[model samples]
Target: MIEILNPTLLTRAAGTGALVADILHTLKGRSTAGTNLLDIDRWAKAMITEAGALSCYVDYAPSFGRGPFGHYICTAVNDAVLHGRPRDYALADGDLLTLDLAVSKGGVAADAAVSFLVGDGEHPESVAMINATERALAAGIAAAKPGARIGDLSHAIGTVLSEAGYAVNTQFGGHGIGSTMHQDPHVANTGRPGRGYELRPGLLLALEPWVMADTAELVTDADGWTLRSATGCRTAHSEHTIAITADGADILTLPKHMRP
Candidate 1:
């Protein structure tokens, strides 16, 4: 369902957005070698509780996933891109990891994802993958504005990925997000402009641009969760929740220090 936030709820959305951003920044800082995936989940749970927010993913269940997610955060590492279920694994130096989170506070919800290298390994391939996703995410956000169709945003993102020489996967892409986590208006990573849903004030959308280095296919892990690249290529994902306002599109999930 698509939702338009009222003035008061939009204000709350700001708070929710800031909280999600801060928590993610904290996680990135605290993560290091030997850190367990579950540790990050617990940290997210604690911070969320302290902020009086509810995790949207803990009980998330869609046909594509195994069942209830039952996790505080999605910890996708290396080849793992989506539906990463935390387990007993210690992070090693230079491990690429992605953290996707969604939380609701004061009746409004915000969702975001970030991918980064774990340790001091300067793997050019991994570094490029992460940078490309971030660049694509920026392009997608730049294309989002009042009256712009969903296709515009998709096209902007796809252009970056295609130019970067990576294949786009549609199994999962961006989507509408509001009072709940996922919403209507599935925004594909690749599409032509001037099509799909039209933008309007008060609408919230989570625009994520993700890509695998050399493949568009996905394989599910044996654990009933975690989607990996079919060719075992490195992956990257970046996202931000944006609110459609009369002024323009206001990005909600930005790191406190990243004002740009």
Candidate 2:
């Protein structure tokens, strides 16, 4: 379903978005060498509960996944990318970690993700991949505005990834998000400009740009949730929840201090 949030709902969305961003920022700070993935999940749960918010992922059961997600957040490390289910594993130095989070508060939901290296390990390739995704995400956000087509954002995102020499994977990409976590219209990572759904004020979209180092193919882990690169190459993902407005696209998922 596509939801055009009203003014009040948009205010609530900003609150939820800030919470999601703050939680991610805290988690990223806590994640380091020897940190267990399950601990990160626990931290997320505590923060969400303290904020009186609901986790969109815990009860998320879709055809693609094994069952209810049963987790507070997604912890993707190294080769793992999307739908990364927290497991019993300690992170190592230089491990690329991607934390994707979605939460609802005051009847509105916001989603975002960030990929960064853990500890003091210099992995140039991993650093480059993370930077590329961040740049692509910025490009996608820049292309979003009232009257802009979804394809414009996708094309902008794809252009960055392609120029960075990374293969684009469309199997899973950004989507409309509002009261619920995932909604329509589906925003692919790559598409032709001037095509697809046209943007309008009050529309909320989660624009994510992710890429694997070598190939576009993905393999599901035995856990039936975590998606990894087929070539086991490092990957990165960046995302933000944006609200379409008269002036332009307002990024809802930036930290409170970072917001204007």
Candidate 3:
């Protein structure tokens, strides 16, 4: 479903976006070398409850995943990339961790994700992969405008990933989000420009650019939710929820501490 948020609802969306961003930032800060993925999930639940927000994931049952995600946040580590279900694994030094989160406040929802290293180990390959995704995400956001097409954003993101020498996977990518975690107008990481839906004011999009170091293929783990690189290569993901406006795009999911 493609939703164009009214002004009031857009305001609510900004709040939800801030909440999701703050939660992810907090979780990333708390995720140390010995922190367990399950503990991170518990922390997310507590924070969401305290903020009086509803989780868009915990009870989520989608076609690609098993019923009832049963986790407050996605804890993708190293080789894992998307829809990573929180489990009993403890984080290790230099483990590339991706935390994806979505939540609703005041009836509007926002989604975002961030990838970062777990501890004080400087894994050059992991750092480079994470940086590439971040750059791709920035390019995608910069390409968003009122008159732009979805393909423009995708192309911008894809360009960055391809130039960084990483393979792109289109099976699951960014999508329209508004009152729900995932919605219409599937935004692939790569696409031709001047194609797909045209942007309009009030439209909300979650632009995510993710990539695997070596291959574009994905393999689901035994948990039935976590998606890992088919070649066991490390992966990275970056995302932000933005609202289309007359001037340009308003990135709503930046953490309070990160806002200018």
Report residue 214 deviation for candidate 1 (angstroms): 0.9
Worst 10 residues of 1 by lDDT: 243-252
Best of the candidates, lDDT: 2
Q: List clashing residue pairs in candidate 1.
A: 94-119
1-260, model 3: which lDDT tens digit per residue? 89999999999999999999999989989999999999999999999999999999888999888778988899999999999999989999989999999998998899999999988998999899889999999999899998899999999999999999987889989999998889998999999999999999999999999999899999999888999999899999999999999978999999998877
For model 1, the stretches where C-alpha displacement exceeds 4 angstroms are none
Taking every candidate in turn, the Cα RMSD to the unseen true structure, in Å, is: 1.0, 0.7, 0.7
Q: What are the Cα lDDT values of the candidates?
A: 0.91, 0.95, 0.93
Per residue, candidate 1 scores C-alpha lDDT tens digits across 1-260 of 77888889889998899899999999999889899999999999999999889999889988888889899999999989987899989999999999999999999889999999998878899889889999998898888888999999999999999999998998799999878888999999999999999999999999999888889999999877899999888788998999888767889999889856
lDDT of 1: 0.91
Q: Give one digit per residue, the lDDT tens place, for model 2 in 22-102.
A: 999999999999999999999999999999999999999999999999999999999999999999999999899999999
Looking at model 2, residue 28 earns an lDDT score of 92
